[model samples]
Target chain A: GAGVSQSPSNKVTEKGKDVELRCDPISGHTALYWYRQSLGQGLEFLIYFQGNSAPDKSGLPSDRFSAERTGGSVSTLTIQRTQQEDSAVYLCASSSDYLSTDTQYFGPGTRLTVL
Target chain B: AQTVTQSQPEMSVQEAETVTLSCTYDTSENNYYLFWYKQPPSRQMILVIRQEAYKQQNATENRFSVNFQKAAKSFSLKISDSQLGDTAMYFCASSSGTYKYIFGTGTRLKVLA
Candidate 1:
């Protein structure tokens, strides 16, 4: 089975430009997660989706960050007016369900570099 | 608020030796799960091991095992007969009733050949 996939493995954009990162979770996975890994820092939780609804969005660094999961399969994280501080590796993970015991499978991640 | 902490930022261990990475967390929820994830240079997070809070028995997977102290709020990962392939950044995470996980800063482990 395919693990998890993220598109545009690397993206470089102007500071004010908007960028959208896409994630394709494993088939039949109902739970998805988004995280940001800043340089030399740990993974920071962004948002989580159980089915198509996001139950937790408190991890979003700012209002410029938004994410949505559609069809309960794929998710898109959009950053509006990106700042240099937003430059980091964005990772997506998925699990069979939201159960605490379920293992989360992770994607290779999309490295976003804001100039 | 729930928080996870990895006191060691970096560490090195000789091949075939044993090393333990320390992790501590603070959570209000009594029922939860603890996890250890390994991220190599490839930037992919891999599940190393996991422990259930309700179970006092430690979890073990091949060369990896965990020392879970429920009362002390400590969860440490022990790796025996370390290999170069084991060199990576290890993250400790905890999740309570919610699905969201609180992750630690991570520990960079280097397995010397």
Candidate 2:
């Protein structure tokens, strides 16, 4: 792909339902990142994936939040039993490599709304 | 833990004027990077500029330049000859050699016609 791509640009779900957000990073990029942005807030670090090694899941907020990157290309962010407070825009970004000082390119972001 | 702060929530400037957005960050690591990103209403996060912690010279890209004071932990964005297209939410972020970027709350800039 020319740039990072996120699926379901907008999602509205019930509070108790689970939702999945997807990200397709640029082809050949080795590092991917996920971030959440609440209303009028800055981007919050969520998770990071670098070339198939163990992901940096320290920022997942809770055990209910989990993410995985398949084949080091596409990724998915799953939220279990979504809560109203979970409503926010989920962003995905990718860099050519973790070691490169190059800036990370961002996707359009998925706006998740939990009712 | 690293933290980024943007003091101004909202700012307005006339077209062709100049405006500066303030940002300060706290980090323990000596090797790190600072960045400024812009998000328009369309929801696209665009990279505006970046500064390396070891570099004393600030980073600049056309009308956008940064004043990075490592000693003070201050990084500010100065928009010269501001245009209506420049009106957007600007964010300041920091990353310690680790890839995770810590972002500030963001400052909304409006260029009045």
Candidate 3:
């Protein structure tokens, strides 16, 4: 089975620029998650989508961060006007369902560097 | 809100020896899930083991086991006969019925051969 996959393994951009990171969850996975991992820091939750239900946006660091999961298969995290502080590894994950008991399969992640 | 904590920042263990990584969490939910995830330098996160909070019996997957203390809000992962391949950053996480998960700071483990 194919694992979760992310696009542009590495991205370098100037401050105040916008970036879009894509994620392709495993086939049939109805749950998708986005997280940010800063240098030497733990994975920080960003957002989550479960089927057609409303996405959880509580973890988004700021108003500049937003995500959209279209067709219940793929997800995109958009960081508008990115700042140097936004430079980090963006990870995507998916599971069988939204159940807490299910294990989330992670992607290799996109390392976004904002200069 | 839930929080997970890993006290040890780094730990080194001799190959084939046993090592345990400590994790504690704060949560109000009674029935949930605890997980140990390993992220190597490759940046792929792998599930090491998992424990159901309601289950009294500890969860074990071959050489990897977990000490789940629901009352104390603690969960620790023990690795026996460690291998160099086991060297990675280990993160402890807890989640309730919600899809969101809270992760610990992570412990960097080094297996010396």
lDDT of each: 0.94, 0.94, 0.95
Report how far residue A36 has shifted in candidate 2, in Å: 0.6
Q: After superposing the true interface residues, what Cα RMSD does each candidate give? A: 1.0, 1.5, 0.8
Per-residue accuracy of model 2 over B1-113 as CA lDDT, tens digit each: 79999999999999999999999999999989999999998888999999999999999999999999999999999999999999899999988867888899999999999
Highest DockQ model number? 3
Which lDDT value does model 3 have at A36? 96
Encode model 1's per-residue lDDT on A11-115: one tens digit a residue. Answer: 999999999999999999999999999988888989999975645888999999999888788899999999999999999999999886788899999999999
Candidate 2: deviation at residue B23, Å?
A: 0.7
Model 2 chain A — which ten-residue stretch has the worst lDDT?
A96-105
lDDT of 3 by residue, A1-113 (tens): 99999998999999999999999999999999999999989999999999999999989999999999999999999999999999999999999998888999999999999
| Model 2 Cα lDDT, one tens digit per residue, A1-115 | 5899999999999999999999999999999999999999999889999997999898899888999999999999999999999999999999998953668999999999998
True contacts kept of each: 0.80, 0.62, 0.80
Best by lDDT: 3
DockQ value for model 1: 0.78
Model 3's DockQ? 0.82
> What's every prediction's RMSD, in angstroms?
1.1, 1.2, 1.0
Off by over 4 Å in 3: none
Model 2 Cα displacement at B12 (Å)? 0.7
